[model samples]
Target: MSKICIVYHSGYGHTERLARAVERGAKSVEGTLVRTLSVDQVETHWSELDGADALIFGTPTYMGGVSAPFKAFLDSTGSRWASQAWKDKLAAGFTNSGSPSGDKFNTLVQLADVAAQHGMLWVSLGLLPRAPGPDGLELNRAGFFLGAGAQSPHGAPEVEAPPPQDLATGFALGARVARAAVRWKIAAGQPPTELATRA
Candidate 1:
């Protein structure tokens, strides 16, 4: 099975909720195992990332950029980049904010740049907007294409924010990445095992 790691930092829980939705979609893939890692705990679970087939990054947008802590985490991966440890790995990202256009797209761009520096392949959300779903919600209400974009109320609980549409977008992005990872491996004659695990 493919192993997918979701590394994130949630300043106020909003981003973490979106990360969970990403995990749900990845785990739904028949031959994939998913793990969520907080940036603060990266050292403890570093091995999981080293062995992952794909990595989905998440963070809350702050000051039109990735959170400070998450930026630190990305910087901390310099060693991995130098070692070429994650080269060619599938990479994707997600970000949360309090406004519909919170410049979270910039955060996603930063993440993609980090992945590129590691020689990783970036995966876009690949969702079409204005495609209505249940409850008349469009597939990507926030209209993000590079990655998932979610908006939570300023001080509201995440469950009551990010809206159902945004969470669904995250879920779809995760599933898309999982599928791509499997395909990439198979194309390389490295069919995944039936089971995978993480710390």
Candidate 2:
């Protein structure tokens, strides 16, 4: 019953779809409860975030970084930082854009910085690719599996959607974060199946 909170800002509906995909993956884990919140929603009760076992951040890459709304949410986390409220919690981030190389890493790095400031343990995508052959997608490839960058044209049809592979990658990352939180709780002398390992 560990809790995984996914906080994200989706400029277009595409990112929101990705957030839901991540939520699906988190909930797939046994004994895990998943909560998905938009940045606006989290802004009102971010202190409650301190109660979650892990926080998975998501955003649509805007001009090479996070959207303005997500940045606003991050700014408000200073209060939590002042109190060290998120210390030792697990954190991960996902970013999506309309190009294959949309400076997604910058977004992830920004999220890592926030987690570090809050004293949380940050987790990378740490994904293995599902390419067809050994010479296929390298684990270090730009868009392996942990983080995703969709490649639809700026105004493509909604049905175009993110690449199935990218969506799968986001889901995997979410599950990994939740599982990591479960392990962190266990190491702290709590049962892994417990809900909300708040600091």
Candidate 3:
């Protein structure tokens, strides 16, 4: 079975919702095992994460980058990187903020950079990079090709926001990771038993 772990830090529960969508998408695939862990739990769950086929990160954008807690989570992987524990593993990221142009790409880039530091393969969202719109040309509303990007409603509960498009975008990101992980594993001699395309 292919395993995908989603590690995330949610400041106001919005990112948590995005993470859930991602998890749901990943879990949709047959023979795929998925896990979602908050940033605070990474220390204890690091082993499980390291053993996974793919690790997808989610974090809220603060200032022009990821939140402090998520940064701490990334920093915690220093020893893991030193040993190249995640080498050859797949990596992707997602981020959320209050505004559409919150410089969220910086956070995704940082996540990808950290993954690279661990010798992991980075996965893109595989969508076009046009401006966000509810149109056929831009299925991912944030125009995020590097990773999923979400815009949450400021001062509103997560239940009331993040827009449907963002949630769907998050789901697509997770599904993409799962699909890629299975393909990679199969190519590495770990044949996936009839893996279905869930995305």
Candidate 4:
């Protein structure tokens, strides 16, 4: 079975909601096991993270980047980076902010950089932006390809913010990562020459 773990920080619960949507999508894939870990809880979940085949990161965008707590969590992975513990693992990220143009892309870049530092493969959102419709609920509405991006109105509760479209986009990201992980696992078991020939 392939294992997927989602690690995230939610300043006001919006990001957490998005993380859950991602978890649901990963679980939709048969033979996949999924888990979600809050940044605060990672101290005790290192083993779980290490065992995952793929990791999906989520965080709130604050001041054009990831929030302080999420940054701390990233920093805490220094030892993992040095050991290349996550090397060859698939990685993906999602972020949410109070405005559509909250410089959220920077947050995704930061997450991708972290994954790169750990020698992990990064997964793109693999979605195209949809024009605004009558209900304004369109997947990839924010037009970000690096990772999933979501906008939550200021002061809006988690249930109301990150509307259905962004959540759906997050789900797609998770499913994509999970599928990639499964394929990667299968490839890893093949002979080097066989893999090269297929490539």
Top lDDT: which candidate number?
A: 4
All candidates: CA RMSD (Å): 6.1, 5.6, 6.1, 2.9
Which candidate do you rate higher for lDDT, 1 or 3?
1
Cα TM-score of candidate 3? 0.88
Clashing pairs in model 2, backbone N/Cα/C closer than 3 A: 1-31
Candidate 4 Cα errors over 4 Å, as ranges? 131-137, 157-159, 194-199
Off by over 4 Å in 2: 129-141, 144-146, 190-199
What are the per-residue Cα lDDT tens digits for candidate 3 across 1-199? 9999999999878899999999998988877899999999888887889789999999999999999999988888888888998999999999999888799989999998998999999999987754353444345777888999998867766455677778778887888899999898888885455674442
lDDT of 1 at 118: 95
Provide the clashing-pair count of each candidate structure: 1, 1, 0, 0
Ranking by lDDT: 4, 1, 3, 2
Give the whole-model CA lDDT for all candidates, comma-separated.
0.89, 0.76, 0.87, 0.90
Residue pairs of candidate 4 with colliding backbone atoms? none
For residue 72, model 3's alpha carbon misses the true position, in angstroms, by: 0.6
Clash pairs (backbone) in predicted model 1: 1-193
C-alpha TM-scores of all predictions: 0.91, 0.85, 0.88, 0.92
What would the per-residue lDDT of candidate 1 be over residues 52-117, giving only the tens digit for each residue? 999999999999999999999999998898999999899999999998888889999999999999
